[model samples]
Target: MRNMKVFFFFLLFFSLCVEFSRGQKEITEVNVGVVTDVGTSYSDVAMLCINMSLADFYSSRPQFQTRLVVNIGDSRNDVLGAAAAALELIKIKKVKAILGPWTSMQAHFLIEIGQKSQVPIVSYSATSPFLTSLRSPYFFRATYEDSSQVNAIKAIIKLFGWREVVPVYIDNTFGEGIMPRLTDALQEINVRIPYRSVIALNATDHVISMELLKMMTNPTRVFIVHMYSTLASRFFIKAKEIGLMKPGYV
Candidate 1:
């Protein structure tokens, strides 16, 4: 993950405290907080990556005396839970920085908390334009911004010579984050966005079918899908089952 590189670079900044670390012992413990939805596939994989990256970082730089002590907190996939976790990490754990909380929504509240506590909030996957718009110096994005994908989408649409396209996205902050930029990019290329397919995160099989049926009624077959998180996989499965993933559509 890109975050691993960012974390590795972050170690250089931690080197500023090397003297403080050396004063204490040969190996200094640098506490870093990781907040995320604990049981999710992404979270589990990311945790493993973080551990592996740290191991590699230490093995490569044995001469360095500072070591990151990762302290994890479960956000339980809720906004309030994320805030609580961040607060606990800052107030009790005394973590110098925090890693994640998964989504843009969770990061929204945590960013303010990080600002108040002077802790750096780094996210690798929260891609909402709204997050960057906040202009919080304490907040760092390890991944591309949501609007950055508009250029690629525009290029694809132009190459296909599609006049009209629909945006099929999850109904959430992360999914909606790219719409304005995507619409503007399409408009610049003289493309019409006939409709937006706002699929609910918890949409069932019937709900997905109803949405697909609605799209079928419309003439626009080309689509730019930006569904968020795990919903994208389910949405594609339903679209394929409904025969919408054929050669006629995108």
Candidate 2:
């Protein structure tokens, strides 16, 4: 009976020791959240869904050892959703950083929350010129800015010797932000904006077809500013269908 008791004691001690060792070796946990803007049905999930892709690209780097905690914000293309998601991540989840709310419209919500909470926000796809205007210290972007892209497009237009051009952009920050700059550049280049059209980011179908059809009449090179991927892809596909494919098509 005494021998059996000793064996039980030893077993308990061994289990405790194993548990303590595991506690010591536990990996550090890091929580990262993502909030996507609501545009198309897919917009709210696009950037958040792409986290694995981003992780794969950075897996070799040593800074990514901790597991990322991603949270989705369905900022239905509005500030409220972004703000709510950011608050949840910052206050509830205690995330170290955040990645998205992809559109500038959605980004504004995240940015506001991030500023108050002091959480770093890394935007992978937002290209709003207003973001640059804010010059917020915490705002960091991975995609090319609209100002630069607009300048390049202007140069391309000039280089191609295009006299007149048309503009087709989404109504949100991505589209609205580029319009003024593009217009200013056109004025500087001595070119005219013969036509202009705007579409909602959430528009699934070809809302700009009317403008496109009109532009096709004059055949002025079209400059399309699309921030949402679904819209961009669809626009390109439609442009091709309408026999409008060229080097500077959009």
lDDT of each: 0.85, 0.66
* Lowest-sum lDDT 10-residue window in model 1: 4-13
Candidate 2 residue lDDT tens string, 104-161: 8778767777787787787766778788777677777766677777778888889978
lDDT of 1 by residue, 164-209 (tens): 9998888888888889899899999999987788988888979989
Best by lDDT: 1
Give the number of the best model, judged by TM-score. 1
Error of 1 at 216 (Å): 0.5
